[model samples]
Target: MLNRKIQPASYDINEINFITPTIHQFKNNIPLYIFEGGDEEIIKIDFLFDAGNYYSDKFLIPVITNAMLREGAGDYNSEQIAEILEFYGASVRLTTNRDIAIAGLTFLSKHYEKILPVFEKIIKEPNFPEKELKIELNNRKQDFLIENKKTRFVAQKKFLELLFGKTHPYGNYAELSDFDEITNEQLKNFFKNNYNSKSCKIFIAGKFNSEVLKFIEKLFGDSLWGLNTEKNIIKFPIQSDINKIHTEKWDGSVQSSVRIGTLCFNRLHPDYYKFQFINVLLGGYFGSRLMKNIRENKGYTYGIYSSLVSFLNGGYFMIGSEIGSQYCNDAIDEIKKEIANLYMLDTNNDEIKMVKNYMIGQIMRSFDGMLNTSETYQTIIPYSLNEKYFY
Candidate 1:
């Protein structure tokens, strides 16, 4: 029987040692890379492709291709695929950002052999069935229509357009007409152009035997497909020189949503850490200056926040809030005052320490799950960052 007794006061804390991950890498002539780690039960598979909206026609192709990936594929219809995954107690999901699309799977390691075929099918032979496309388009259109009614949504859209010109891919709004124009043929073409093995990296983080590694290599190796020779170039747009603000009034709105921001730099910037600390002090937490001054003290609004949004090419700092419609202008003015105050005053060491501890705590909390940890590393790896940044 295992001992359940509590430790004595004399117990030495230094005697305890936690097992850290054993990192392993598989190198092949193939362009793809896989990172794996785990001990027994769960296996996670992440397939990353550089086929984000920024690289394609910004309107629809990126989104449509990602959504339709699991609709149907070789030897499996959508229902069949779902049923098989559920039976094996597995989950498959897709995530996208401005620069990449990630298809991830988490399954019991014991049943990996049963689920691997389904994964192969989804990756190798996505059919992009016509019916699924129609259903998805309708759903997206309805969502957009509903979001347009919210003042916050309206403000956010207008803010992006103002920051980056309306014609730019990062700033454009999606129209129902745009969805109407996308056909199944165009979706298939986009997939064909972007889904080649050369542009992808497969990351497997979990317990696996030699067989699984061999399977991954075979699935993504020379036997399956060849490298893409075309150049993938992305250019960052020029930033707006002047500070701009725009608002669109929504009739009968009970709350006014506000967003304030300007273009900044990427995670690789030398001042990234300092800027992170600054953001936390400004609005990155419930106890932040913005929240304390605007919500807790004055009671001008229900909630407020500020954050640094980092992208592959550049980043931005934004302050967002929702206030009673009558208090919209007041909330905006107060938010600006707080920002100005930070620049005007000399920050004390005690306050800086408090904010630093808060930010560190928040980051630790975000990594409490396997999925989130894997994603954190994924985001960092592309930017050439390591765990030392957090420490």
Candidate 2:
């Protein structure tokens, strides 16, 4: 019988195990990582490239190139490709991040052979049609214009500018005018340069077979898929100028959004886990100091959170919240006091133990399936890291 009143006793995290994918090299220099089997007939395949927003020569080139991949590629137009995938109950997605662009596919293992050629064609022969490019440009530009009016959007944009500075790749933003300047020729050039096997790493999971593996090797490994394009040099020099607060004033804003943080060491550091635990105790969880004092006790704001976000080259620790405009100053003061308290006193051993346990549970839930396990591999491989990253 389970007791609702009594709580389970806490213990130190003893061990955490992660599934590491078996890596194979394709003849064309692309590396593929695999997690063998699961109960589901479905599988996920991912193609990762460093052609993210960071690598874009201009603000929109990388994104525009990635977006136009499925718009038209090798015999199948956008609607035809969509119809085929929809008929097979499969899906395709391309996501652009600060560091990379991922082209992902999910389909039943039975359809792997049928769609592998289509996938190959999509990867190697994307034609950025003028009609599709025009439609996408207008849609994205109009969407941004609408979202730009929100306080959250304005705050997040300003936050990146402050964190990375105006000159850094991560900081430079695409403006409305930049959208108008995107050209099909530029997209073609960028794709030829960056979206090649030389810049790609692959990950696949679910019920795997040797035939499918051979198919992958033949399509990607045995061929010169990228035509051996040379990668361009993109510089991202870090700035020591931090510890500054950037405020974007909005006259109509009834609520003030605040982002306070500083760039810190990435996950490769030994102290990262410790710092992550400290962040949780500070505000990473509901019972954290900031939430308890600011929201639960003082009636100041609705919510608050602390995060230690690790990137490919750098990381940052941030405490974020939005509050009534009138109490903005008070909220800032309280946030500082909470942080100061951490350095001012030693944390209790029991409290530290609890946070560690919470993190362990979180990791278990995150890596629960083969798909998630493949994602876990994706995150680590970008940094030249392996399973030991967790321990």
Candidate 3:
């Protein structure tokens, strides 16, 4: 085996400067902002809205609206949209999380001028064609049904239900009945209420000029801005007083999946970094304590890991593992023992230094590409943070 201790010639990472994007406040009096960058090869545009599921009449409204946005708009059908975008070598993506929805576009800088009009039509006039909605709903329901049969899925869903009550927006699972309950009229109403200029923020990165800015102004600024019909703020319930444990058996499974966690704080909390460091020492890395104890030393499982997940409305620290079904109880007991030990004693200086280095290396890896960098910002912007937090 190769030596893992061969240090590279240059350990200096000073050249990696995390620069915050230049912000340009639009004069249009709309809730629009832009982050301008100078790369001339690729251009990215992100339209963010608070149309997340929390504000909808039902849990799946945001899901349907986001999925249907790119299916058809204006004179183009789903296939035509795909063909046009492919012809220009451009990509259009739509994503929805617990509290926000984003529609984004990326294309070669040379073709940006040609592709901007297509994006404008898609964003401004999406037609929720009935046939497309039925197909998507059926596809999603089937996927969910399949996933529910797995041990990991059972453990994860149960863990969330335990952390937050089953009725809570963050904890609720979508049912096939819920999909059938959704109608095209409800989706259109949800879109009209949330996808207005006043509720959106635009982010542009890479190769923008005065003319491009003018085009953006004409397309987005001149449009009438309307406020959302309703504003609902999601408040995560307090962490449960009890340390909850749940288990479900799936017959004929070779391995059992386990998840353990509790509701935690958002990124704005001062303890976010501390908890992140603690998590690394516990199970965040391959060489973490949990892996060493469960996989390396005991040979009970192939892998084990944990993470701190922060959403717009709330966050949590989760540990997950898959092991031979016979070792399920033993693995869970060891995990709890490790967690209790972390709270009882302090880690040593050597371990602390190693975790810090590992975290820094991971942060650098996350910024290695343009798309990843853009996504990093998208994840952080909702917390009212800039890149400086990571640097």
Which pairs clash in the backbone of model 1? none
Tell me the TM-score of each prediction against the true structure: 0.88, 0.93, 0.90
**How displaced is residue 40 in candidate 3, in Å?**
6.3
Clashes by residue pair, model 3: none
lDDT of 1 by residue, 11-88 (tens): 212221212233443343333333355455788888888777667755577887888888899979899998998999
Model 2 agreement with the true structure over 1-391: per-residue lDDT tens digits: 9997999985655776778788998887789999887899988999999888777748688887888898889988988888888888888888887778889889999998888788787888997889999999999999999988877677767777778876677766888799889899999988887888888999999997999899889888786666465665656886535654544457877877888888888888889988988899999998888999989988778998989988776777778887777888898899989999999766787777777777888888768989988988788789898888777
Whole-model Cα lDDT of every candidate shown, in order: 0.74, 0.83, 0.80
Every candidate's CA RMSD: 4.5, 2.2, 3.1
Model 3 worst lDDT window (10 residues)? 27-36
Error of 1 at 239 (Å): 6.1
By lDDT, the best candidate is 2
